[model samples]
Target chain A: MLKFDEQKVKENMEGALKLRPQINEVVDQIHERGFSNICWLGIGGTYASAMQAVVHMKEKTALETFYENAAVFLTTGNKRVTKDTLVVISSVTGSTEEVVDAVKKCNEIGATVFGFIDKAEAELATLVDHLISYPLNEQLKFFMVADRFMYLAGEFDEYDEFYNEMDQHFAQGIVEVEKAADKFGQEFALKHHQDEIHYFVGAGNQWGATYSYAMCYWEEQHWIKTKSIESHEFFHGMFEIVERDTPVTIYVTEDSQRALSERVVNFIPQICGNYTVIDAKDYDMPGISTKFRGALSPFIIHAVNNRIDVHIEKINCHPMEIRRYYRQLDY
Target chain B: MLKFDEQKVKENMEGALKLRPQINEVVDQIHERGFSNICWLGIGGTYASAMQAVVHMKEKTALETFYENAAVFLTTGNKRVTKDTLVVISSVTGSTEEVVDAVKKCNEIGATVFGFIDKAEAELATLVDHLISYPLNEQLKFFMVADRFMYLAGEFDEYDEFYNEMDQHFAQGIVEVEKAADKFGQEFALKHHQDEIHYFVGAGNQWGATYSYAMCYWEEQHWIKTKSIESHEFFHGMFEIVERDTPVTIYVTEDSQRALSERVVNFIPQICGNYTVIDAKDYDMPGISTKFRGALSPFIIHAVNNRIDVHIEKINCHPMEIRRYYRQLDY
Candidate 1:
C-alpha cells in the first residue's frame, strides 16, 4: 500500500490470465510438433524465475528440463539443445543482451525458440521463432512462460481449469497479501531496517522466489547483504551463520517439500536470534484447489513478497529502483 | 604454508592418483554396460564440487547429466534416476545422513552408484555398489569423482594418459599454488581483512570453485558474508551492489571461457573500489597442457585459495574450523 500499486498488481495478474488461450495454442502446437527436451533461459530475475519452472517440471512432470543463465548458456552451450530442443526465454526488457544472444544461438542450433518479450517491438520479439509479447512485470511474466511450458510438458490435464481458478482467486490473493505485508512487512522492516545481513531459505518451487527476492528485490534494489539458499541445503553449511540476532527469512511452499522447510521453520527460532517465516500455506486461496495450491504457491508468494519490498523501501527511505552501479554505469 | 601441510597435499594428490585404477575399472565397466545418464549427488561442499563435473560435462560431452543436492534429491526423486542412471556421490566422513539416504534411494531404484568415501569403514562405503576409499581432501576428491564421470561419459579416449599426467604434474602444481597463495593471499587478507562482504566471480569450470570458496570456506568456515556469482551473471543484477570499495574476487580460469571472466576482470576494477583477480594462468602448472589447464584449474585454484583461507583466519584471529551450529548442536 505504501509504494505498491494494488491496481497495477491486479492488471498484471489479469494480463497473464488473458494469455491463457495463446499459451494453450502455442503449447499444443509444440506438443504436436514433438520436442526432445525443454530449456529455460534468462538472466538475473528471469533466470531465477525459470528455475521455478525447472523445479515444477521436476516435481510434476517427467520432462527433461534444463534451466540455465542466458549469459552462461552462450559460453557453455548445452549439448542437449539440439534441433529437437525447445528453448523458453523471458526478458522483461526485450533488449537484455545475453537473452538476445542466446535466442540467436538457439536459432543457429535449429532449436524451437519461444520468447516472452515485455515489449512487442523489442529485439527478442524479432529474434525468437515464437514470441509472446506482453507488458513487463517480471513476476507475472514468469508465471505466464513457466505455466505455458509446464502445460506443454503434459503435467496438467486441467490446465484450463487451473487458469480459470487463477482468474477467480489471484485478485483476492493479492488483497490478502497486501494486508499481510502492511502488517508484518512494515513491522519487520522497522525492527530490522539497520540489519545489513539476511538469509533467505525456501524449497521446491518457492525456492526460486526465495532466491529472486533476496538477489533482485533485496540485494540489488537495496544493496543489502543476503544469501538465498535452498531449505534443504540450509542445514548443510549455511546454518553455521545463525547468530542470535541474524535475520532469517524462510519462504515455505505448500508442496511435497513443505516438510523440508517446516524443519527449518521449527529449528530457526530455537537457534537464530531473529527469523521470519513466510509460509505460503498460511495464505487462503479462495477458489484454488489444495492440489493446485502447492504448484501455484510461487505466484502467490511473489505477490506476498512484493509487499515486503514496498515496506523495506518505505522504512529505509531508499528508492527501491535506484542502483549504485548496474545500468547507471556501463561495465 | 601457514596451516597447510605440503606433505599432506602431496599425499592427497597421490591418493587421488592411487584411485585411478579403480576409477578406471569402474568407469570402463559402466561405459561398456552403458548407462542412460549421470547423477552427481552431494550436500554443501560436495554438491558444489559435483557442480564442476556437471559444467565439465556440459562443456566437453553431450551426456545428459544431473547435479543435485543430496537432501533435495531424496525429497524430489529425480525422474531421470532409473536403473540406467549412474549416481556418483562423495561423502568425506561417509556419514552424511542425507547422502546415505539418497544412496539407499538410488539403490532401491536399481541405479548404479559409485561412492567416493573418505573412510573405508564409513556408512556410505557399505551402501554404495562401488566405493573408492581415500583421505578426504575436497579438491582432490572432486577431481577423482569428476574425472570418473567425465571418462564414463566418453569425453576421453585416453583416460589413463590423463591420470598419469595428473600423477606426474599434480605435486608441482600444489607447490606452485602454495607459493602464489602465500604471496597474493596474504597481501589480500591484510588489505581487506576487515571487509565483511566479498563477491566471487568465475566462469567455465572454475565457477564451481568460486562458489565453493565463497559458501563453503568463507561463509561456513569463517561465518563471513559472501556472494558467489558466475562471471556472466555478475552483470545481470549482482553488479548493482558494487560500490567504490566493494571487495570483488575474480577467478580467471585458463579455458575457452577465459574471455568470459576477463570481461569481468576488466570491468569490476573500474567500478568496485577494491578487487582481487586470482588468475589460474598466473600459477605455473608445470607439465600440464594448456588445453587441459581449464579443466584442471579447479584443483589448482583449490590449492591456491587454501592459503587465503589460512591468512583470513590468522588475520581475523578466528579459527576457521569452529562452527557455531554445524555438527556442534543437533537440530
Candidate 2:
C-alpha cells in the first residue's frame, strides 16, 4: 500500500463515472450523425489499453472497428476510414506527436474525429471534430470510450445495467479494490519484483490490461524486463522462454475465454517456477452482477495492478515517475 | 555468411517466383467470385508475416481487411465475417491446431476460407474452400496474398509490374541478399550476440518484419530476450529502457515513413553503444527499379535477418530448429 492514495483512486473512478451522462449524450450525437465504421487510434499504452473495448465491440456488434497504432496508421493508411468514419482517439497530454499527426491526417481524409483527452485546449482537442475532456486514468478513459461504442452497438444491455450498478457503488468498489490489493497485489509484487524477466499472460479483454501493465507499468515506468503474451499465442513461440525457474504472471478473467487462461494457469505452474495468478473472480464488485463481472475484468485487473505498481516502486527504491529517456530525450 | 546456402536460397527464391502465375490465377478466381471483405487468420510467425500485406491492402484498396490471430479470432469472433467474407489463412505444416480450428469455425459461420499451405492433402487445405499450396517462405506467401488484394483494389499495377520484374531476377536477388548479409547482417550478429536484450526498431511495413524476427526468430528459436517496438512509439514509452550500452537493431526502409525511421536511427546511436542499422537502400536488387526498392524492403530485410540468424546460432551453439516446448510439449 506504499504511496497508495485511497481517496484519489475513489475520486478518479467517481469523476469518470460522473461523465456517464456526457458520454451517453456524445454517443447519441454519433448515432444521429451516422458513421460507416469506427477507428480507434493511439500510441504505446494508449494503443494497448484500447484492445479490450475493440475486442468486445468486434464480438457483440456488427460495426466494423479498426483498432490501429496511431503511428502505424500514418504509415499504412486505413482504407476503411472514409469521410463517413468516426475515429475515437485519446492522448493524456493532447500533444503525443504521433497521435497529433494522426489527428491531422484524419482531418485531411475528412473523417469525423472524436477525442478523449485530459487537456481541453490542447492540439489534439483542436484538431478533433468533437472532444470529450476527462481526467487521465487510461482504464477510465478507455472504459468511457468503450461504453459509448457498446451503447451504440445495443448488444450489451445486461452488461451496461451492471456497469450502472458499479457506478452506484463506486466508493464501495474502491474500498473492495484496496482490500483485494492487500490480500493479492502487494504480496505478489513483494515476492517477485526482483525477477530478471516477467511474463504477463492473459486472454480476452483482460489481455489488454496485461499488455498495458507490461509495457506502461513494468518496462516504461520501472525499466523492468517484461513480455506480455496472449494465452492463445503463448504456445506459438513465447512459451519457449518458460523454464523451471522462469517468472510468470497470469491474469484470469471471467470472460468467455477464461478457459484459455485456465489452460495456461494449469500448464505454467507445472513447468514455470513462479506463477503469480490474479483472478478477477477473486475481487468482489459489491453491486455488480456476476453476469457482467467478466465484462469489467479489464478495469478490475488494472486496479489490482496499480497496487502492485506501488509495491514494486517501494521494493525497487525507484520512483515510478522517473524516466531515463521517455519524453526526456528527443528521438 | 557462416551457414549460408547459396544455391539452395537461389532455388528457394526461384521456386517461390515460379508460383506467381498460379497465385495470379487463384487471385483471379477470388476476384470473379467477389467478397464483401478480407479476413486473414494465422498465429505466431504466420500472423506476424501477414502485416505487410494487410497494410498494403489497407492503403490502396477500398476493401476492408481484417488481420487476426487464429486463436484470438476463435475466442473473440469477428462480427464482420459472413458467407460473403473471404478469409485467407496459411500454415506450413497444415497441422497448426488453432488455425485448423479457426478454419472449422469459419466453415460453421459460412465464411469462404482460402488457405496457403505446403500440401494439398493437409488438414488446413482440406478445410479451406480453396487452397494455394506453396513453399514455407513467409515473404513469398504473403506477397501472393497481398498482390491479389492489391490487384482487386486496382491501384498497384505499377508495383505489381515491378514485382514481376523482380520475380524474373529471383536467383540474382539471392546473391544480393548474401552480399548484403556479408556487409551488414553477420557483422551485426557477431558484434551484439552477447547482449542481454536487443531492441528492434522500425516503421512502415518493416515494423512487422522486426516484430516477427524478434518473437518468432530470436525469442522462439534462440530463447534470447527481444522487444520489437515501432519507431514512433519508441519515444513514447519503450525508449525509457535504453541505456548507454543497450543493443539496438534499427531497420530503415525506403517507404514513405523513411524520415520516421531516420529519426530513430539518428537518435539511438548517440545514447546507445551498439547500433545495428540495416537500411534496405544498401541492398541492390538488379532488375528492381529505384522507385520500387522501398516496397521490396520487407523481403530484403527478412533475407538479411536470416543471415543474422545463422551467426546467432553459431555464437550460441544453439541450432535454430531446436525447441524446448513449441510443438514439443502440449500446452
Candidate 3:
C-alpha cells in the first residue's frame, strides 16, 4: 500500500472505539437530564458529518433531531431550539470560529451541549457541558450517541448487540475496506489527477460523505475543481453537464436509498464514458449485521474513500494539509 | 437589453401577483382546516426555492417548517410529516417523476398538499388538494403562501400591508431591477463567457438563488461548469481553491444573515481580484417597505440575476431551453 501505515490506522480506530464507554456515559447523562430534541451544530466537514447522523436518525428513530450549519444557525436561530434542546457539536481544532460562537450562543440559550473535540484544552471543550476528546472516527462517535439515545428511548433494540459486534471487528473491518479499496483508488487517482473537474454523486446516508470528500478533500486539499450532487438531484440540473468524456464518480450506498443511486448508475453509463461506481455492497464486513449497515455505511464509505484521498495526494504531489487562504493569512 | 423583453417580464410578474387572491383563498381554507406544520417538498431548482422559503420562515415565524428534497423525502420519510402537515410543492411542468411520486406518498399519508403548477392540466395540478396554477416568480408564490399562513397564525401582522405594497410595486420593481442589472450582467458575461469555470458564493436568503443559478442556469441550461457554495461554508473548503485570477461571484443578501455574506465580501477582494459582489441592498424598491426586503430579497435577486442569464445565453450562442439529456433522453 502506498503511504499506508496499517498499525497507525488500527490504533486510531481502536482509540476511537475506546471512547465508547465515555460516549455511553455522556449519552446516559443527557438522557437522564431529558431534552425536548437533539440538535447537531457544526460547520464544513463537521457539518456534513452531523447531516449524516441526522439522516440516520430520521431512518431508525422517531427522536426529534435537527442538523444545522453552525454559522447559519447562529444568524437564523431555530425556534425549536430552547433550554431543553440537546446540542451536539464537533471540531477537530476545537476552535472553528463559527462552531465556537454557536456553542456560546447555545450556552446563552441554556441548552445542554455535548461536543466531540480533539483537544481537552481547546476553547470548544471548555464551553461544552460535556466533551469527548478522542475524535478519530467522528461518524462512529455520533452513531454511538444516537444509538444510545434511541436505546434509552426504546427505539433501537440492537444497541448492545451492535456495539458488541463493533467491539469485535469494527477496527479490522475498516482496515479490510481500505485494503480492498486501495487498488481502485490508486487507479482512479492516476487516471483523474489532471482532470479539470469531477462530478461526484451519492444518496441516502452517503450524501454527506460525497459532499465533504468532494469539497473538503478534493478541492481544499488538492485544489481540484469539483461539483457534488445528491444522486436524486443528479438527474435534475447536473445531468445536462455530463458528456461522453466527462469524469463522474457515484458513491452507491447499501441503504434503502440504494435504488436512488442505482438510478444514477443505470443512467450515467448511457451518457458518460468515463465514470466510476463505488458501491458499499462490493466490500465485505464480516461482523457488522446487514440491519445496521445502512446506519454504519457512512463510516464504511469514509474508510473506503480514505484510500482515494491518500492516493490522490500522492499522485498530485499535493500535501493534504496545504492551504493557501485558510488560516495561512488573516482574512 | 439584448434579448430582454421588459413587457413580457412585467406581464409575468404582474400575472404572478394576480394569483395572490387565489393564493389567499387557498391558504385561508387551509388555515381553517389547520395543519400541525408546513413541509416544502421539491427537487432541484424548486428544492432550492423551497430552501429559501424555509430560511425566511426560520427568521420570521415560530411555525414548525421543513424543506426536503422530494426524492430523499420519498426514500426516508420525515417523522414530522403527518395527516395534519401542510405540504407545499411547486413544479413548472408539474409532472416531475420524483415529485409526482412524492405527492402520491404525501397523499397516502393524508397530509394536505398545496401545489403551484404552471398548467392547470398538469398531472400535479390534478393531484394536489389545492393547486395554484400560475407559476411565474415561484419564490414570490411560496412567500405569499408562507406570509398568509403566518398571518392566519398571528406570526405576521404586516401581511396585508406587505401584500398591498407588493401589489403596487413588485412587478415594476422587478423590471427596474432587471434594467439596473443588465449593463453589469452584460459586462460580466462578456468577460467570463470563455472562462473554464466559475465559483459562486451566497448566504442567507440568497443562497438558493446562488445555488439554482449556478446549477440550473449555468450548468443545466448553459452547460457551463460551475460550483456554488454558501458564504459561511466557502471559508471551510472552497476558499482554498480560490486564487487571484479565480472568477468568483458573491450574492450578498439584506437578511439577518447579511453578516455571513459580508464576511466573504470583506475577504474575497483581498485574495481574488476577479470577484464580483451582487448585493441585494443596491437595488431600490420604492413602494415596498424595508421591513420586508429580507423576505423579498430572493425574488429581487432572482430578477437581477436574470440579466446575467439572458446575456450569457446570447454571448455563448446557447439557447437556455436546449438540453442534450434532460427530457430529450430517457435515463
lDDT (Cα, tens digit) per residue for candidate 3, span A129-176: 998888568888887788889899998888889889888888888888
Q: Write the per-residue lDDT of candidate 1 for residues A218-318, one digit (tens) a residue.
A: 77887777778888778877777677888898888887788889889888877876898888877787888887887767766776776777777877889
What TM-score does the first chain of candidate 2 have? 0.95
Higher-DockQ candidate of 1 and 2: 2
lDDT string, candidate 3, B1-331, tens digits: 6777989988988888888899889989988977788999999999998898988888878778879889888888887788999999998888899899999999999999999988889877888999887756788899888888888889888888988898899889988988888898889889888778898899888888788888899989989888899999998887887888989988888898999999999988878899998888999988888988887778778877788888888989999999989888887
Q: Is candidate 2 or candidate 3 better by TM-score?
A: 3
Fnat values, one per model, are 0.66, 0.74, 0.76
Model 2 clash pairs are none
Question: Which portions of model 3 miss their true places by more than 4 Å?
Answer: none
User: Which residue pairs collide in model 1, if any?
Assistant: A244-A273, B244-B273
CA lDDT of A325 in candidate 1?
72
lDDT computed for candidate 1: 0.79
Q: Candidate 1's error at A183, in angstroms?
A: 1.8
Clashes of each: 2, 0, 0
DockQ of each: 0.65, 0.66, 0.75
lDDT of all the models against the reference?
0.79, 0.78, 0.87
lDDT of 2 by residue, A1-331 (tens): 4666778878877887777787677777888888798877888878876677687566577778878788777776777788998888877889888899988999999998878888898967889987888776665665666667766678666656766786898556866777677756677877878877788899898887787788888888988877778887787777776788778888999887788888898888667877778888888888777777766777777778878888888888989998887777666
